[model samples]
Target: MAVVCSKADWFVTSCSTTLVALNRKQSGEPFVFDCSKAEKKPKESDGDNKSAGEGSEEKDSDRILAFAISASGKHVVLTDDHKRLVLFCTEPSWKCISTRWVVRRCTSLAFTQAEDEVFVADKSGDVYSFSILEPQKVGELKLGHLSMLLDVTLSPDDKYIITADRDEKIRVSFRRSPYNIQAFCLGHTEFVSSLLVPAGHPDWLLSGSGDGTVKVWHYETGRRLHSVDLRKFGLDSENTEKRFAVSRIISSPDGQHVAVQCEGFPSVQLFAVDCGTEGLLNPADTLTLPLSPWDVTFDSQNQLWVLLESEDMNVLLYQHFEQHWRLCDSECPELKRITDALQTQWHLFKDSVELESRFKHLYKVNFDNMASYLQKKQERLDMENKKRAAANGTKPNKKSKTESGAVPHSTS
Candidate 1:
């Protein structure tokens, strides 16, 4: 997967195993870092060999789960499925500053507004705060939930830490006193997969869920403001039930527009931020994509950058202009360079285990579609049979005795 961090002055791209930082103006020496060489920190001594064995068995080796650059664009942090967290300094040199081990595999990473702390959320429902200023210090536990946390972010003012869990609960906790809960934004039927406090909307929250709805909420009052069902975009109840969760919801830098990407969908939904309509999200446009985006973000100029899930590792850019968004006329050279490097990496390891996994994923998708189609066909046949029976006025057959005391008519 290729991830791009587009800021005002520079853009950084991170493939599965490498990171490249390029300055937009200077085009100077690009800082390249091979993330595959990031060393994992040794696990703490539990004094139990059985527990150690269990942990080792569950660990996923060398798979990057999430990565993010700080708001200031000076620091970068990435977490892997093996429970390793690595922080990097992007300036002067692309150097790994620290490699810390976590208790469980991390699901999301967010940098604080001050850029002094990095918040890490793990599958075990715990959030840990790592002090970037004190690189030698280990991460300390901040707060936790009963369900697995899917995403976490801080309010614009940095006064509250909002977290979304797999149980459809979004909890807001005071940042200074995390133990004190502020409010709960509820109503999602399925897991709340993603959350965002859009720029300039400090009191509002936007969340996407497995239920196929993007809801707008008044976080401070815990009130449901409005919601837009993605099902309106051609998905039905059956399709939504097949676990197509909204993968990401991002607001543009200026906060005037928002983009939503759902799992298993190859198109991006765009909405305008309608503050006048009680903070509702108004439908703007939809950008049909060639492939499902692995990740999506908007640069300073409100150009949507989509990193595609493809063998070629392409990144598509769409510019917002004249109240509409459209693909750029020309390709970005910097993005092309990053994709070329990613393709090279893929070719060198085409026969590796990753290739096998990719094949398995593709097979699963095809198998699921075939199964769904067959199931629907069977359902249609059953409905038709019932209709036919009704039309024929068919009833249960009755058994009767014949004149010779023999059972002449019997129910089948």
Candidate 2:
């Protein structure tokens, strides 16, 4: 299922072939972008037939893969399975700025600190930089990894372009000189699924991995600071390694707190950054989810927003009151309006989330080769015994124990 991707005041949710964005500051209608309705257009530069406006057939796989809201919150970008990178401008009104194409289906997209350039990370392990100023321009190959990249983000100063991959490594490189390697954040035993440079903490980086822990890092130096194991906070019955991978890591606007969500798990683990040590992760609270969460984010007001698997009450808002998160689902009418608008295509959201559990295969499976080999050897010996008994003229009752219901001995 598609997850809700948000930054600042605007929170957006995408499903199969469409996306909905709403500004919390206004009661205006949510902007709906449907790939099925997007018409393919010719690029002015190379006449490449990409799409921007609506009304044309798209692929069945043309679902939104990743999206990002500019740090300034004025621009929004999302990549779809159709290899189309769609951009939107929020001010003056929500408008489609351009439709560009990526070399491969993107796994993550991020706007630089300046929002002048957007980086696209694809399954091919390559990142392409697209120009926001020159919306019609094609992307330039930036840098790449040896394995599929799952998440990409820029340092707060836009000095470093950090990327995490399925091979369990986070590479930090110079944004201007992509080949200038800064450092690598290593330690995750499984695929890294999400990355974030928390607000107000430029030197610090937070990453979530399939191994079930979120690690804090100093991006420039590649120093590991702290880590949080989400399994310790999930539902008691759901503490197995299978429910581990940290799917999303979000910081409150003030950067005082960070929230971590595990895929297919029913809890959001909150952490207080720099609470005890200067640069450390401290467990604060675990927001018990009634259902598995799709994503979590903190709006400009520091209110926590959670998108769940349920269609009836798809979005929930929480306020940090008295050192704990208090529910405001029925109290916030603005959020209520957004939830009502999403209810129509809510099934799409549900279906999108169901498809996201594809990571379970990333774990290793077990097999015993020795047991099978020993059993075959014993069967061969029994066959020879049966033949010798037939030639010795022994009664058929002495059938070499071949026809008997005797259990075979298993060796350690």
The lDDT leader among the candidates is 2
TM-score of 2: 0.85
Put down candidate 1 lDDT per residue, 1-412, tens digits, no spaces: 5556676556776655556666655545666665456774554443332353335556456666778888867898888755678888877656789887776778888888898898999877889998899876878999999978989999988888899988789999988889999999999987888899998788899999877899999987789999888988764545544556787899988889999988767789999998787778989998888866767888777778887766654667788878899786435675565455555545423322232211122111325786677667666666666677788998423323342234466689
Model 1, runs deviating above 4 Å: 26-30, 43-54, 235-241, 311-313, 331-412
lDDT of 2 by residue, 163-262 (tens): 9998899999999999999999999888888999988888888998888788888878888988776656643454363446778889987988888887
Which stretch of 10 consecutive residues in model 1 shows the poorest summed lDDT?
355-364
lDDT of each: 0.76, 0.80
How big is the positional error of residue 130 in model 2, measured in Å on the Cα after superposition? 0.5
Which prediction has the highest TM-score against the true structure?
Answer: 2
Query: In candidate 1, which residue pairs clash?
Result: none
> Per-candidate RMSD vs. true structure?
9.0, 5.5
